[model samples]
Target: MTFFYNLWYSNSLQYKLISLMLYPFSLLWIIIDKLKFLMTKPYTSHLKIICVGNINVGGTGKTPISIFIFKILKKMGHNPIFLTSGYKGKISKPCIANNDVILFGDEAIILKNIGPTVVSKNKLEGVKYIENLNSKRKIYDIIVMDDGLQNYSIGKDLCFLTVDRKSLFGNEFCLPSGPLRQSLNSCKKNINKIILTGNRNFKKNHNILKKDILNSYIKVDKVSVKKKYLAFSGLGNNVKFFDTLKSANYNIALTKEFEDHHNYKENEIADLIKLANENNLKLITTEKDIVKIPKKYHLKINCLKMKIEFDKQDLISLKSLLKNKLND
Candidate 1:
């Protein structure tokens, strides 16, 4: 899957041929996506809805950005509840998310730790659930949709599209042909703002205006530089995790990458432990990936905590913008 994902961004002749062959399917996908938006009437809730989403198919740091917004809202004295589709989770109906990775997936569990999070397959159902829950005591003042920009069934008060600076828009084509979930033009029209995440020095190349774009970077917690570590993760962008570790000056002995949201088997974990032990290195991974591992092994592995840090001016503007929107 990673190989194909890389191919999507490749500009080689083979990629061009493959993209051409898949272009028809991409067109069909776009047509169906647009039709869904046209057919469905979005549900509007009294509670303010802020969506953190992306045009790309893979992760664009949506979870972190959503968490950041949730924290901001919390500090501003508003209760914010997360609403997510629980992408790989088994349970389909709307319910409060829990730490069971098999039932709610990693992202849902992570969001649940920060505040109240509802996991639902149908986002509309999730919004309705939040609305009903708030009616009694008004506990949740806002609903933050983790990744639902393409979800046309719920009206959003403010929508933020997260874009990784490293991989802006793979091949600049829609799915099957490239990484984009929707056309860039459609994204600009739907999103209230674009949150660019990654290296702060990365230049802007998209069509969105500079004023509409907010810059942010992942800030990793300090790790012991003396110890050699074996880093691994099953994130949408594993390279980004590895890059973050390198930037933090961690002495990585070896690194391994897995498919996004991979279900780690006991043997896999055992193998990793053996390899790390053999190389005299500590096992380290992202916070999102650590939840799936058995609790017994938790003490053996180190989790790299990360947070999104926005530019100073951008942070001020975002806070003000959010306050104004909530007041409205």
Candidate 2:
């Protein structure tokens, strides 16, 4: 996956030839993806389901935005629970967040900390699990799917397609050919609005369907550390996290990138600590990445906590849409 991701972005002649060779496979991927959508009848739930997903394979502010929605729903006096496939996690049955519960997925751990969370391989089964709990306890009023825009097995009442304006649809190709999980046109019909998670102002004149652009960015807390520090993360866009630090004038001594949702080992943690001490640098990483680290080593590292915020009017518009949909 990392090799293909790098090749998809490379401009060298060899990479282009490789991409061309993989183009046929990408077409096959698109056909199979489309057929899956055509063949599957989405499972509908009685509760309102809002999905925050992206066309790009990697992170584009989905976690933060989903958390934002979860908080908003809480404020609105409605209970909301997160339902996810528990990517890369061994969650065969529905499980909720608890200190004693072991969360196998990086994103799942983070989401669990925010509110009630359920992890299951099947989205429909996850929803049903939560609904069953509600029947016994009346614990939740809504369900939020963190990243299932491409998964058509679960019907959604609202959908927000997130995009990083700078890297939207890299090379305009799919899968091994490029970064897109699905073709741009195929995703447009499912997206109710586009959330641009960058500084570039999205203009209506931009070449795409006319849709509302939610101007926002991942709002990180200000760090007080003044010394040079080593920044590292296992994120889809590790560079983006580093770039965010650079934008904030952080004294980045060095940076390292790892595959998204990377599981950390004791040896790797020790290595990072050793490297940081050798360079007299503090080790820092993203909140999402930090959660996966063992607690005993947490004091050895720092994390940049972030949240997503939309403009006032834009947020109001979003809430209005949600309210209208739920009322239906």
Candidate 3:
């Protein structure tokens, strides 16, 4: 998958040839997706729905941005609940999220830690479940959808399309041809704003101007610069995690990458621990990956906590936007 992802994002002659060969399938995907968008009548919930999603097929900091928005709404005195599909979880019906990563994926558990989270395969069902739960007391004021930009079944009051500044729509082609889930033109039509996450000095290459974009960068907690560590992660963009560690000046002795949302086996974890012990290095991983590991192994591994920090002006703008939506 990583190899294919690299090829999709590549600009070489081989990438061009593969993309040309896959163009027909990509075109079919685009048409089917567009038809779904046009046919569905979105359900308008009484609660405001703020969707944090991405056009890129892989990670673009959507979960982090969603958590950021949830915190902001909490500070503003608005009760916000999270709505997610539970991605790789076992359950199919709508239910309150729990710490069981096996039953409800890592993201659900992460969101549940912040506030109430509803995990449902159907977006509309999730929204309705929230509505029913709030009918008596009106506990939740808004729904912070983790990833549903392409899901048109539930209408959103505010939509944030998160983009990694470092990898802005690689190849600009859809699906098998490129990293994008849909074309930029189609995505822009549904989103309220583009949340650009990455380096502060990154230059813009897309049509979205600075004014229309909300800039953010990952804020990692300070760690010991002298301590040698063996870092590993199973994320959509493992390179980003490695880059973050490098930027933070961590002395990473070794690194391991896995497929996105990989469920670690006991043997795999044991090997990592053995390797770390032999090298006299501490084990480190992203918060998301840490949640998936068994509790007993936590003592042997250290989780790198990360949060999204918006630019000063963008923070102000986000507050104002949320306030206006609440009033409306």
lDDT of 1 by residue, 166-214 (tens): 7888787898888888977667778878889975545655744333888
Error of 3 at 265 (Å): 1.4
Give the lDDT ranking, best first: 1, 3, 2
What total of clashing residue pairs does each candidate reach? 0, 0, 0
lDDT of 3 by residue, 1-328 (tens): 7667777777789768988898788888799889999999998888899999998877889999999999989998889999999888998899999889989998999999989999998989999999999988889989999999999888889998888887888877788777778767778788878889865545664745233888899878777788999999999988878888877888998999989998999999999999999999999998889989998999999998887898899899988988897788
Candidate 3, residue 8: how far the Cα is off, in Å: 2.0
TM-score of 3: 0.96
Candidate 2 displacement at residue 58 in angstroms: 1.5
User: Looking at model 1, which ten-residue stretch has the lowest summed lDDT?
Assistant: 202-211
How much is 32 displaced in model 2, in angstroms?
0.6
**How many Å off is the CA of 96 in candidate 1?**
1.0
Per-residue CA lDDT of model 2 for 1-328, tens digit only, reads 5676667666778888888888998999899889999999998888889999988878787888888889988888889999877777766787775542245487787888998888887878888988899787777889999999998988999999887765666677888788888888788888898877853233322436467877776566666557788999998887778877876667898998888888888899999999999999999998877877889999999887666777788889878877787788
